[model samples]
Target: MRKAIIITLVVLISSFVMAQKPLFKVDTLSIELSDLSLHAVLTKPSNIDNPPVALIIAGSGPTDLNGNQPMMQNNSLKYLSDALVENQIATLRFDKRGIGKSVYPAFSEADLTIDRYAKDVRSIIEYLKEKQFANIYVIGHSEGSLIGLIALQDISVEGFVSVAGAGNSADVILKKQLKPKLSAEYFESVEIILDSLKNGHVVKNVPPQLNALFRASVQPYLISWFKYNPAELIKKINAPVLVVQGTKDIQVDDEEAQLLAGACNNCSLAEIENMNHILKTIEGGMQENIQSYSKPSLEINKVLVDTITAFIKNYSK
Candidate 1:
């Protein structure tokens, strides 16, 4: 009986030790940006000598640092951050202004223009500069790419990575995405809506059918967003750029990726076959493609990681 008790205690102690093991230690910080407190998570390597850090900017909408969409329950960013930590890379991710632990008077989506977002990035960069990291790189995904690009005008980052970024204006991309999703009869109506926005016209009382496309709060944002072309912006960026596009990405096609690459004087493009917009490998039909978004078991393509790791490793040295 004494031997049995001892064995049980040993197992419990071992379990406790394993549970206490640190996979990674992340620091949660509140940064003051534009008179508001922006929440950021900074994860560092366990042991390193002046390691380079990557700042991860989440995509459009109310995406948190963990890459979770407010409307959805996906946690893709968390997985990506964990993977990066395992690779001995440090990362910083944060919530956008007025979203998730961020203080705001609730700015309308219309007020959430790219310039405003860029200001937020600038604030974060300034904060990072104080930390004295060896190198600072911005890794922007989707709409965040535009924010990062605009921020570059103010902050001096070592390099940038655009993941599934759009090459054209948001208006043009929205129109293209809506055409196939909407019926032929509704195409003209959608075009009219986009035209009104392009002309900087305030559209009140949007049509019931168009509510999904244009929210009352997001109208002004769409108006501001439609003005900038990513490809043009990419051309203006003097820093080394890396564009990663998944071949199976339905939201942004390979053509857009190519356009971004072509615009940048110093840029490298990595096309990951069968990888979806979220970086998961998808097989079968369109339904199957989206299903990967919910599957946490689905890992991002190793090629994507290898490409990014190699680029950062070469550049950091």
Candidate 2:
């Protein structure tokens, strides 16, 4: 009866999967800010009413609401959203102005600034407050962490979560990220451009090889971003803070998370080992860790979901 036993086992597995089916619904929403519209997706558990919502903010670059770029399809934020919703928490993730479906003709790259993104975050919070949710939480990844902190200054949120956020200022992180990738001559020249930008002056002539980075058009935004330090800003937040850092995160060191945790008395640091910048666990070497960026099929680390869910649930009213 070996064949009969195999069929019974398959039937049992299918039944178990059906029992754990998803119970969530997703809908598109948008908010208007200064004549520009930012689009977002709200994923709410079908079984929970007026559930506490989490605002998921993406990291740097043209990262879409799903935590993805034009070429990279890894659904880091999307999967995070699904996991949170499964735990009965609603999630709201949006596209910044001029990115993805949030693109606007009036939005110009030259007009962009870090404050612009922070303003969007504030506007979204107001929108959510009007919706009368049970409570609201802010979860920012990478640069979004600083933007969220900036937004939280004037508004009251349930709590805030920092995932792979930089502890130092923008200029400091830029220099560290670029030192290994640039030649000595170019590296020193890059520092000169950064110094000028830090002083609020635009460098007219950036090295041709580094034009993509130090271009004149992008300098204003850099100047605005480099002004705030995450460690300094986190001190001003009145709400509870949770800093999540991965040991394998090449972009941001685990030590950075400690700085953030150390700055805020109420902040708690969650140090996860073998987890990378994209929130995936490392099973092999550098190639596998880097490859996780493009692998959408691979699931995110389970420990991350548990940590976030427990934190939010503990604070939910």
Q: What RMSD, rounded to one decimal, does every model reach?
A: 3.9, 4.5
TM-score, per-candidate, Cα-based: 0.90, 0.93
TM-score of 1: 0.90
Instruction: Compare the candidates by lDDT and give the number of the best one.
Output: 2
Instruction: Compose the digit string of candidate 1's lDDT tens values, residues 1-317.
Output: 99999999999999999878776778999888656889899998775656778889999877888877656545667767777777777889999897888747756655677788888898899888898886888999889898898888656888899999998888888888989988887887888889889888867868898897777777878888888888988887767899999989999999889988888889999999888888777777799887876676777777777777776777884
* Model 2 Cα lDDT, one tens digit per residue, 1-317: 99999999999999999789768888898787878778999999988799999999999999999889999988999999999999999999999888999998777888899998998899999999999986899999999999999999889899999999989888989999999998998799989988888888988877788899988778889999988989999999988999999888989987788888999889999998888998988878889988999999988889999999999999998
Candidate 2 TM-score, C-alpha based: 0.93
Residue 54 in model 2: lDDT: 100
Give each model's whole-structure lDDT. 0.83, 0.91
